[model samples]
Target: MPDTASDTTTGYQVLARRYRSKTFGEVVGQESIAETLERAIDRGRTAHAYLFCGTRGVGKTSMARIFAQALNVTDEQAEEVAVGDAILRGEDMDVVEIDGASNNGVQDARDLIANASIRPARSPFKIYIIDEVHMLSNAAFNALLKTMEEPPSHVKFILCTTEPHKVLPTIQSRCQRFDFRPISVARIAEHLTAVLGSESIEADEAVVLRVARLANGSMRDGLSILERVVAAADGRLDAALLERVLGVPPEDIVKDVASAIGAGDPAATLRAMATLLAEGLAPERALDGIAERFRLLLAARVCGDDPALLGTGSEESAALVEESSAFEAEQLVHMIALCDAAGGRVRVSASPRAILDAAVTRMALSERFARAASLLAGDVTVSSGATSKKKSLKVADSTRPTPPARPASPPVIESAPEAAPE
Candidate 1:
């Protein structure tokens, strides 16, 4: 008997794999590029060689496959779901997927060139999809240049890369390039919401939003996160479970620390951080949460308090807007920098707690400086921390001794007499 346990036919399909876009219409967060490509297909203006480039998991490879499908897909197959599935599964002989990072030698390029010359096994057009195309050796690129520049009329090349700049300029010049942008947090959340509904799994909107933000603009990553959360939830996924699963602190923890920093209270800030540590939150976790919070606050400061732009719920948006008022734009920028630097240091530093503490304290001190500046400028408004019955911050006083009254203008009568003589 065959090894049934090892068979993939009965294996579980990951959400990312199950929901991979089979048609252009199913693609998310790249509507403009999809529309442009659709128009090109309609007009029969498809380029011989195409370059698709973007950050990881942003659908560079998927779009390449879709383009290939569109090129070779028959009019009959256009409306057939099985045909589309076959194309996505790479079961169609005409569409070949090549990993450029592995087959990066000159010999591989030569083999590709030879293969390009051959006619399609079944479909009208022979398509080659090479992913991470930048990893190909210089010699391989040189060998492929001539054919890439002028290939057989029936042959199509779709080059996908995360770092397009690494590809040789000559090769890039020979192809029509389309840049895939990072999907926005909102689009990812919207897709995740639909995904949860499709799975019949109930998830709090906050959980979905958190997952979207955590994915950092990668649909594949968002789906993966959703899959993990669903697997762990047993049915219902909420913000608490999501945070626990992600090793992130609670929203209130971050908000408290932010409010403390805004209040210019080092003691309160450190106290909040200590509470987080005592609760088993790692220093890096705290730092990441704080950094993310500052990012939203900064966005709110710059983006006119739009909840969509901040990618937050109504309550969170209100909190962000309120927190945004606690600091000047420059102060937010400075705090973000401090948190970022601390984050970098904590990754390698021997004492992450020390670094995090210092970072939070530095932010609090910065607020104090801003408050002192305002006080010096005759703005009596100071930070709450600055006003203490036990201790007071004496500003520049805004009072000068009147400069001795300028000696009464040195007797204007004598000056008038001198003017008459002159």
Candidate 2:
């Protein structure tokens, strides 16, 4: 079952906030971390400080809130749903949610230090959840070092940062660190399906999967994209509607381009590129799609139709395995490299279309270059099973034997002619 909170306010709430995980078990894709935190709380071994580190939309802040709720809310207070709700909503006096980006100063740190000494208003623990903690200046970090190292028994700290590397090492050392991983595509897709079902919106599996892939392992991003789709949905969602809303080229067009490149057909490849450009797909995005296709193909070639490795459905995995046979692993690697180089140039190039065209053409003609390389490297083998070596070509009369000692006679005649002239 999907875990969701009801929004009673008249104002609209985005899916991300409305569907935020309220309990540790409701957290998606970070089950191990959630379980560990839950065990610590159950064992009465809650730490004084914790550092949550991960990329955006991967539940760092959400996990912090859930942890705080678990620590401060007891069974006696469980009957009081308002208390748990306040903590989860980050509105409780005990759970203070601070945006470090906005209040990152020595004074802010000092204020936090000063407030830590005070007791909780209602809850057992007074928790400070500082998000984007790496934004604090050096002086601010230095000010908080001692407090973070040794806070009052009633006070707890939860530090969250997208970039953990930027946080001072001394601060990190004092807290128990939990590194959150990016959600998997399968998990994101499943979660999206559940969300759509809850909203009574029906979407094609392909559409849901496409949105999940576009989310790129961020559940929040997946929800945001799905929100846009739901807002624009008419009746039932389909692939055409998805492509139209996202303004991306159709999957068939991308596959056509990849097939042309794999077949070494420059004209067909350019025609496919023209179609993509005519459809208003950005050149950089087109390049990304092509690169992604080749990446899947490479995976298929190496891993042999493993859907897990390809991150595709079984049908798509089979199709990729079939398509991958058109190009060798080495050719796919070279094509991917060409796409990467062109991608870099396309970002800054005034004529991105031209760059894309040239890149596809180079990929289409890659076999010719491979052949030329083989010839240059003297690797040509003959029918007699003899390998050629780099040497000067010579014409020899193999059928006839030549007389010996003619060089000595020629030298003697030349010496006699020189003596006569002297």
Clashing pairs in 2: none
Q: Which runs in model 2 stand beyond 4 Å of their true positions? A: 1-7, 380-422
The sequence of per-residue lDDT tens digits that candidate 2 reaches over residues 1-422 is 33333434656778898888988888999999999999998899988899999989999999999899888888776545788889888899889999999999999999999988999977899999999999999999999988888889999999999999999999999999999999998899899889888878888887888898889889999999998888899999988888888886688888999999888899999999899888888898899888888988999998998877777778988999999999899988888898899999999999988899889998999866765676677554223333434332222344456667555444444445555565
The 10 consecutive residues of candidate 2 with the worst lDDT sum are: 387-396
* Residue 144 displacement (Å), model 1: 0.3
TM-score of 1: 0.84
Best-matching candidate per lDDT: 2
Candidate 1, residue 164: how far the Cα is off, in Å: 0.5
Best by the TM-score measure: 2
Task: Give me the displacement of residue 195 in model 1, in angstroms.
Answer: 0.7
**Residues 1-422, model 1: lDDT tens digits:** 11222334767777887777867888897888899899999999989999999988888878887877777767655445555556788777778889999999999999999988899865778999999999999999999999988899999899999999899999999999999899999999998888777777798877888889999899999999888777788668988888777777888888889999988899999998888777688787788788888888888877766878888787778778878888778878888788788888999999988889989998988845655776677565533554633223343543545455445555555444455564
Model 1 CA RMSD to the hidden true structure, in angstroms: 6.3
lDDT of 1: 0.82
